[model samples]
Target: MTREGRWSEPYEIFPQASGLFSHPVLVRISSQEIWLFYRKQQVGESISKPYVAFSFNSGVHWLEHRLLPPGIEGTTRNPPYVDRIRNRVYIPSFSVYESPDQELIGDSWVEIYNFFSRSWEGRMGPILGGSRNQVPIEPAIVKLTSNKLALFFRNASVEESYICLSVSTNQGISWSKLKNLPWRSYDNSISVQSGRNGKLYLFANSAPAGERLTCFSSYNEGITWNHPKLIDSGYSIDPSTYLDRQECMHHVYTSKDAQGTQRIKYYRIKEDTLLLNCPACWILEDVQESTEE
Candidate 1:
């Protein structure tokens, strides 16, 4: 979110994070050392475990591995994203399957991984008072200009769905109330980053006929957002965005059910043109033509 640059070819980045994997996820670069936030679900009932991959060669080759605790053993839910706040590195992810109906009801445990100790400690959920009505998932961590960390996620239900936000003062140790956002979507994942002028650029999934990941920009620190805009023509979702050295936004996503073939997409933004014919991206030429006009 500091500067913008193009993304290089993102090869099969997560060989370790496979099997029973439901929601595959990723995060941005490191302020000090560059790393990838991902998960592994190699077991049926086992939850997805949080993982880290260090990259020094511009992601051409990476040191991908699993990060574990001292005693307790279980997997993570989503990709664990890390951001620095006041010199402390905070790793955040949600845990599931440890209890009954933990995922659907989201009686989860939000945890933080400590780099200094190489250990992850956390607080149990039933978060937001376990309202018996609200179901929250898919957390996105944002570092504000003032160094406070705000975790935003989508609140979903067959009855109702909305976006929500929570704050932590001590670096993902604890969370505040889980409040709802003004809008909702079917399966929209958001990519949020700090803009140069203190605004926030949030890319989300809007309700089009195909329902793809759309765009929204905020000027007043996420208090409100601009109208949604389409980023590409395919059925793109699960946005993970980062800015590089030249101020251009780099986005990586999964192009699924497009022309009946699924593939990962790596793309970037330069003045206006959207490029997608990389080795990583899957082409939905027919869908693209259909969505036009």
Candidate 2:
């Protein structure tokens, strides 16, 4: 937890041994109730399974660690969004399938979990057709209205790298075709969250293979994005929105150290700072000037 802009010491919530446990997605249902979903894969395995745990007191304690139902992989890279009004949790996830020729293919979908029944309510996608140049995976979702949602995907295409968008009007049952956004991201996870002030904030890697972290704000529910604000520069990956405070946005991502060790890092940026309408060229100029100072 963060207090007065200082993060507390990190503690372990889950223990894993003899396998790899990663891609954690934290969902806060209320001030007191929280849920964490992650992937667990054994050594030398090509496929991974999803597991979940609950934190009843704002993540102070985690309990009831269990595997999800058969065929249900939880959120892949981003947190699930909870619909308080309808009692539904929308999880954007993907599964990996190995071809006969030892090639791995990814299929993306949105799994709906019903809070009222405590069961999964089915899914809606394979949002992108298996195109050699597109290859969408790791979807991040943001609710636009009571019955509408927008999904942003990180493209895995090495030939053409760009983020894509898909919108759903009838909840998460159906979605529109995948379309390219103006921003560029390559094989990196992106995070999207709808702010309380009616704005959509997207965090992504601006460079082709993960060197810069940038935030883009959309005032019109993702139809258009304003100039991006540079958040950090380096090997930053898997940016996820952890919390939305009144004055700032809280994010957690992985950054590489000097020795190339991956470390979890926290970043907090004022919401108003990203809402500024400065041009990208001017912002780059200012950053260069500051570096020379």
Candidate 3:
């Protein structure tokens, strides 16, 4: 889409799936090249297989669809992460385990995609969870500092209901034990992004009014956060799509249309108001080293 609100014509790219194709995650690889990751599933089924397609002419034409690794379900709210320096894209996915008796056993897998090699990685290696029905599903990742990356997930366990956090130094290869975040979020999707001002902004629904969308800021690379500022209320928001700019933060959320259908909405919040009451906020001049990994 152009800045003037002009939208390009839509085209069919993944029309060969048996049931349905949904959850398109777009990442721009270059001025003319882009990548899209999506899911295909059978009718009335819950599981979905992940597939990816590349567009070389700015999405005007898409290449052949390639199915990602099996054993994991694709994501709807979790978008693939692009590391421009490394020329790799990281995808977050999860899968369930069932017993021989057809009973749900445990949520035993979490998958990550290495786009350079066109392969998948990551499993339920170290995160803590109980049963198949109660575990983290969506994983949102952000680079905190050099050699440091953070992963935020939406978990189903009551005790670990809040958005969970884990850190990795060697990228997503291995992670530290999971820890519960202080803020509460809808058990759907969470958003974490590095702001242009060198701070981290986390978007989630807070307690008492989980329906109200709120934003929090962390200056020391997610070590601590300032009080949340409410963005909007009364409507549910999937804080998945995010954009960071020098002046403001932009994100796309899903809301209900007048006809009761879900529609994508765009919103922007300026950075000045976000740090109104923040303590010891780091200024751009104070940032000497590149925090991006």
TM-score of each: 0.65, 0.81, 0.77
Q: How close is candidate 2 to the true structure, as a TM-score?
A: 0.81
The candidate 3 region of ten consecutive residues with least summed lDDT is 284-293
What's the C-alpha lDDT at position 184 in model 2?
77
Tens digits of per-residue lDDT, candidate 1, 1-293, equal: 22464444545664654464344444434534455645556666555655556666655566746555532222222234454443334444443232364545553345555555555455433245225445666666677665556666666554556666665555454566666655574566666766555455666666643345765555555555555457766677667677666767777776766366866777778512222221212111110001111
- Give one digit per residue, the lDDT tens place, for model 3 in 1-293: 67887876776765555788777777777788888878778789986778878898988788978786665455556555667777666555555455698654333234555556666545534444433334565777677655566667776555446666666666666665556667654655677877654577888777443367777787666666677777767565777646544566667777776687877778766766777876743232221222222
Query: lDDT of each structure?
Result: 0.53, 0.73, 0.64
Pairs clashing within candidate 3: none
Better of 1 and 2 by lDDT: 2
Clashing pairs in 2: none
Alpha carbon deviation, residue 15, candidate 3 (Å)? 6.5
After superposition of all CA atoms, the RMSD between model 1 and the true structure is 11.0
Best by TM-score: 2
Best by lDDT: 2
Which whole-number lDDT from 0 to 100 does residue 102 have in model 2?
56
Residue 14, candidate 1: C-alpha displacement in angstroms: 8.2
